[model samples]
Target: CIILQIIPSFGLPAGLFLVLLIGIDRLLSVYFPIFYKFKNVRRYLMYHGLAIICYALLQYSFAYVYFEDRNVICGPPEIYQGKAKALWGSLSFTVIILSVILYYAVWRKLKNTPSMANDHRLFRSILAIMGVLILGWLLTITMFVLVVFLLDWRGLFSNIHLQSL
Candidate 1:
């Protein structure tokens, strides 16, 4: 359970951050083509990469301190339950909202412009990627909320194990 919880706790945020970085990169390429071409992309990428790493580390540290427990169970203690739920819920919402906003801005920017076939294809691909990300994360968030708030986990786990056979 600790391994399961820890992996997603680090991965979800990092994935969202990577999406945001991609959006920013696309915006830069579209709006500042010359500067974007001349800029040291590696430096910018390194900085953003480091920031994402730091953010993941911080999240992992929080989970380690407040959520992980080997003595009782491989999950958060009862005292930290609310905090853990709130933390993940808020992070999910934040990612969803930001992705929507970024996608909207990109769509609006490209709507009036006459673009080459390649550009249009790229735009469509980006839109699809964002759509998939939002859907997947939304489903994950819903499950987390349902499991944490709406259902009894003891029974849920039992039913899941029974059905797996």
Candidate 2:
């Protein structure tokens, strides 16, 4: 139970952060090919370091909150439950929107390139990959929304019961 709660706190944020990085990388390569090509190792290392810091912060915060109660089956106490879902949902939506924008930019760029103009295979592959990624994120966002709604509904009912007592 403890492990389950701890893993997602770090894992989901890191995974979403990687998606954002990929989108940014794709946009950079597309719009500023020369700059992307000329980017030094230090710049790349700095981006990686930032990602690490974000992951560490998420992990420590979640662990600190959940560690005080060993009986928590799968998440923080009721008071903190909906917050995680909301946070993940927002992140997923942001990633989805960024991916859409980046994919559209790549498509437009590819369409205008003489060499890639007739290459249906490359376009098809890119579209397929993007479709998969978008679908996955959409699924995650849907689940998070549902969980948050359900948790809130349950909390409301529990509160009513407490008032009655």
Best by TM-score: 1
Q: Give the TM-score comparing model 2 with the true structure, all chains together.
A: 0.64
**Taking the tens digit of each residue's C-alpha lDDT, what string does model 1 give over 1-165?**
656566666676788777877777777777777988999878988988997888777656556566634354444222234465566566656766676777777777787678898998989888887778877877877777676767766787788899999
Model 2 ranges with Cα > 4 A deviation: 2-5, 55-80, 116-127, 146-165
Task: Please report, in order, the local distance difference test score of every candidate based on alpha carbons.
Answer: 0.70, 0.62
lDDT of 2 by residue, 1-165 (tens): 544545555565566566556666766776787988899969796977688568546644544564444344464222123354355466556666777777777778766766654465666586677668777877866676676655555488888999999
How far residue 22's Cα lies from its native spot in candidate 1, in Å, is 1.3
- Work out the TM-score per prediction: 0.71, 0.64
Runs in model 1 deviating more than 4 A are 3-9, 68-81, 142-165
Highest lDDT model number: 1
Whole-structure CA lDDT of model 1: 0.70
Over the full model, what C-alpha lDDT does candidate 2 score relative to the true structure?
Answer: 0.62
